[model samples]
Target: MKYMYWLLIFIPITLVARFGLQLNDGLVFLFCCFGIVPLAAVLGDSTEQISLYTGPKIGGFLNATMGNVPELLICGFAVQAGMYSLVLASLAGSILGNILLVMGMSIFIGGLKYKFLPFNKNITHNNFTLLGFAAFSIVVPFFFKYSGGGGITEHSLSNFSLALAVIMIVLYLLGLIFSLITHRDIFDDEDEDEDGEKEAPEWSFKKSLSVMIGATVCVAVMSEILVHTVEGAAEQFGLGEAFIGIILIPLLGNVAEHASAIMMAVKGKLNISIEIAVGSSMQIAMFVTPLMVILSALLGNTMEYVYTPMELLGIIISIVIAATVFMDHKVNWLEGAELIAAYIILGGAFLVFGIG
Candidate 1:
């Protein structure tokens, strides 16, 4: 009953958004962008519970899928509306959301509780390969655009993008198989059941998977509305579609992610903190964006993955600061504060509407 209350709340929002989209396309997108906050907040709390019982790989996969719930739904709806630019901005926003806004706020809030924490080094190592893939992926859109390739059409960028997506999706499947079956080392979370609040409930593979999917659906539906509402909200604030997405959409999504970071941070789980920040960024960059590309192609929409100069620099700076900070495998409250400051400065600069 209690869980159903959440489902109830979300379902209505989704419906309302659907109606809004029918009425005004701009408003629907606004609503979709706003959907991420509560979803993130809830998932951050629930994920720990699920992660403890189900173990990390499943948890990580769950997190990867659920963490992206908003993006997925918004993209789905956006594709139907032919708002390709909005979709693209949201993609870029998510990476920034995870790296700076989520990570920064998480550290600050978590530092208030505890100064530092420990986390898995091995997790950090594996994440690098994904991050590298993401970094490369981030650059691809730019290369395609200026490479004199008609900005995404000349090289049959769609064909190329689809092929690239095939490779990535294959990689995702291989990674999943490797973790869950072939070599289970990646998912074996030995430290899952920490914080002995309640007796750990046994989760069948079926139950965990079901809840994961259900939660994801709720997130997606809500997020689609969020995107819809964003259009209206942008009008209200007199903002650009890109500004709303690149700035606000990601920040709202960070609500859930920020909580995850803070929790890990307060536990002084710096490695997990960094991983959540960096890993989620990688997922957005490599996994989510590519998946969206493939979906766009199949849906008969042209989805381009180009990044603005601002986006490129943001990714580079975000990775450098984050990696440099986490390299020593330790964190202080001061360091956490520094990260938050950096984000503030960057965000302030980006807010200049005419600067672009």
Candidate 2:
């Protein structure tokens, strides 16, 4: 966290690019992208600190809600700008990155020290069940779009998307109740040493609150600036918006969670590592995507849950691979390698095809 402070220099640089020097859109986009990383780190840290004062259940809720703030903010701005494709791509990218890039790296690094690591099978099953539900929700909308029997008007699609969004949100809430209340014990880390005392937070509650607010505001501002420049930047760099959304934006937004997952894995805390990766993906699918649908409508952009065939294919492949790897409750380095390889192949395909 201390080292992340150095990256704060990019904040001023981004501001200068935006208002002072009036740099090119591509350059401003680059600066804002880098600037958002450290702010995200601060946001995570502040959330953790604030959670210390709230108790486990509420704290877990807060952490889950704030985990993807940067991505959410960026997507919100993108929605406002009517970059519907980019928003949807970023949504898919976030889920894929967590399930593949983050989870795979954690398993691979953790496997380097241990030949085989086993986690809670019950939790794994629950996660995959939720993931399956999420996949179904997303797939239905695409089915609606393509199988409408004839031409589908924008109003009809928007209405269908809103209906699905409401259902998804309800399902997500049910999941929260199931996991956090009735089945809480299933997700608990059994390996945690009961006798080990917890350390006190360094920051006071007020300080944590202040930092969270400040970081969130800064992230929002940066995200707006970053999204506004995305089109110009994409054209300037000979890159497609899909490429930036699927690869770059997701990576930038989840950098903090990615680092934490890897660190937990390296420390042999594979349970926490798995939770962070899988849980983040579940959040994106269940909460963020649906919320974005509603938000986009309110913003007058009215994005549907429909996805291009390639994007849908990528998501389905990712879900299937993740389910297979974690189904046995055991993981090895080779399994991790397989996940990373799959992600790379999908990324390459997206890069080449520039899939909407």
Candidate 3:
């Protein structure tokens, strides 16, 4: 019955999309996101359970790789199809959306339901350490931006971008070292509810491992279709690739995460809710973007890391506000509202610029 339900729902959505590609490509592109992203999220989340159980570093690693499966798949296809800018902007947008929008909305709504929520502060702080470096990861790309270069194709540009990817990998490795070696205790779940300590869900670590590998496989399957559909949609809609990247793609990539955050909130697991929101975002930024670049390089395409001025501004503001709201040990309704509002402001700006 479960498999039947999934097949009935998801298969039609995908077929509607794949077939619709023959008629109206934009519609097909839209449905693919509406369809495929959720599927990948299911895969990614199942995989995440294994990662969480294996320990913090492994969990972080797993989430980092799989959290943005839809985005990664789309971007990889985009790269293969030669939509380099779209892939790059999508990476930037995914990070910002996951970190800022998903987390922000979850906090706001969850806090409104319950006045105060508790989370694993030590783990959050450890994640922040990675985020700090993630924010800094923007430096090199921005450096190349200020120089006279025409996005990825600019002379010596792809090399610089690739080099930056290498640097991010090294820094990420160091952060992992710091996370596991320097602060291993941060991952321990403290049973700390007033009524009594509740046991957390035990993840299917082996299942998650299998699914993680499976996600990589499915990604290869759908990417080609996604790339073709996106290009057709973009051309038909008269939308620029940049517009698609900075707005549509990221939001689509994160829909599953947004749903999970809300579900946790409804369940009254505020700490777990908040953890999913923030942890997922950190993974997107620190890990997903670099992986795309590496994969693009492997696929014989250049995934540039150029950010528009507004994109950079939005990212910086989102990270700062998100970090500030969560930095404290306590979370309240007001902070949640503020986070949501901040995201709204960013979203408004994106649609405005995206349509421009």
Candidate 4:
């Protein structure tokens, strides 16, 4: 973990280039991209450390809330810049990336070591249902758009999206209540400990809180630099904004959490790994996406819930593949491989077609 901090060097380099010298946008973007990885890792680590003190329920809630700080910052900046399509693409990508890429890698690597791993079916199913509902919410606005309802105008669509966003947020809070309060034991892996003794936190609460705050601040600064350079970088690389948003942004924002999930799986804690991956996706869907909708409106960049056809299709396919894999309550390396393969294929299609 100490070695990961070395990536922080890019932070100063990015700052100096952006402020001290007029560096190439591509180079600034590249440096900021690498720089954010360790910051995100530190952020995730600090959050987990904090969770150790909070216990599983509240800890899980903290993880869900803070896990996507980078994404939120990036998209917030994008929204301010009027890159609404980019913002939506990043949201979609985060959801797909977690459920398919991160979860797949975790399960694949863990399955190789464990042969087969079982997770808590009740928790998994509940999360799966929420994921499906979230996906359906996205689909709803699109349905209204093409349904030929003569009364549906831009204002009406925006209103529809606003209402749905509020509802999703309400559902998200209800989910937290359900998992963290009413039925926490069913969803909590820590409850499996036979001794029922909570482990002592390695860090002092102040230290954990300080690190989480510091890492988050650094990520926010880096994300601003990154978002500023995105347009130039996209043009320089000949990659469409949609492709960059869908693949590159989410990958950078999520690399730290991705590493944590894979590590948990490698340690034979499949339940924890699943929770990290699926819970992150659930957060993106239920919390992050709706939050973006409300934020965009407040920022005067009012983005509707409607997604491009390809983006919608990509999300639905990813959800279906993930649901299929987890349905049996058991997972093997083959299933993991399948998920990764699906992601790769979808990525290739996006790269080739540049769908927004």
Top candidate on lDDT is 4
Whole-model Cα lDDT of every candidate shown, in order: 0.64, 0.83, 0.66, 0.84
For all candidates, the clash counts are 32, 0, 1, 0
Query: Comparing 2 and 4 by TM-score, which wins?
Result: 4
Report model 2's TM-score to 2 decimal places. Answer: 0.93
In candidate 2 the C-alpha lDDT for residue 47 amounts to 72
Put down candidate 3 lDDT per residue, 163-238, tens digits, no spaces: 8777777776776676567765665555533446433545566766676676566555555566787777888887
**Candidate 3 Cα misplacement greater than 4 A, ranges:** 1-21, 48-65, 147-153, 192-216, 237-240, 265-271, 299-301
Show model 1 residue runs off by greater than 4 Å: 1-36, 109-116, 147-155, 175-215, 354-356
lDDT order of candidates, best first? 4, 2, 3, 1
> CA lDDT of 282 in candidate 2?
86
* Candidate 1 lDDT by residue in tens digits, 1-356: 12323434545555665764364655544444444455565555566557667555555555545666666677678877777777777777777677767677766776677756445655665565666666776677567677764445544766777777777767766755765688666534345446444437456545655665675777776765665566676677777776766776667666655666666666655555665676677777777778878888888765766667776777677777766666666556666677777777767776775122
Listing every candidate in turn, what is its Cα RMSD in Å to the true structure after a full C-alpha superposition?
A: 4.3, 2.0, 4.1, 1.8
Candidate 2 at residue 50, lDDT? 76
| Residue-level lDDT tens digits of model 2 in 1-356 | 65887989999999999899999999999999889989878877887677668643445456546768998999988888888899899989988898999899989988998899777776677777888998998898788778876788778889889888888889889988997889887677656546354548899999999998999999999999999899899999989888899988998887767776676677666766666778788888988888989998887767888878888888888999999998778999999999999999988988998876
Error of 2 at 314 (Å): 1.0
lDDT (tens digit, per residue) of candidate 4 on 215-262: 898988999889999999998889988889998899988776787778
lDDT of 1 at 134: 66
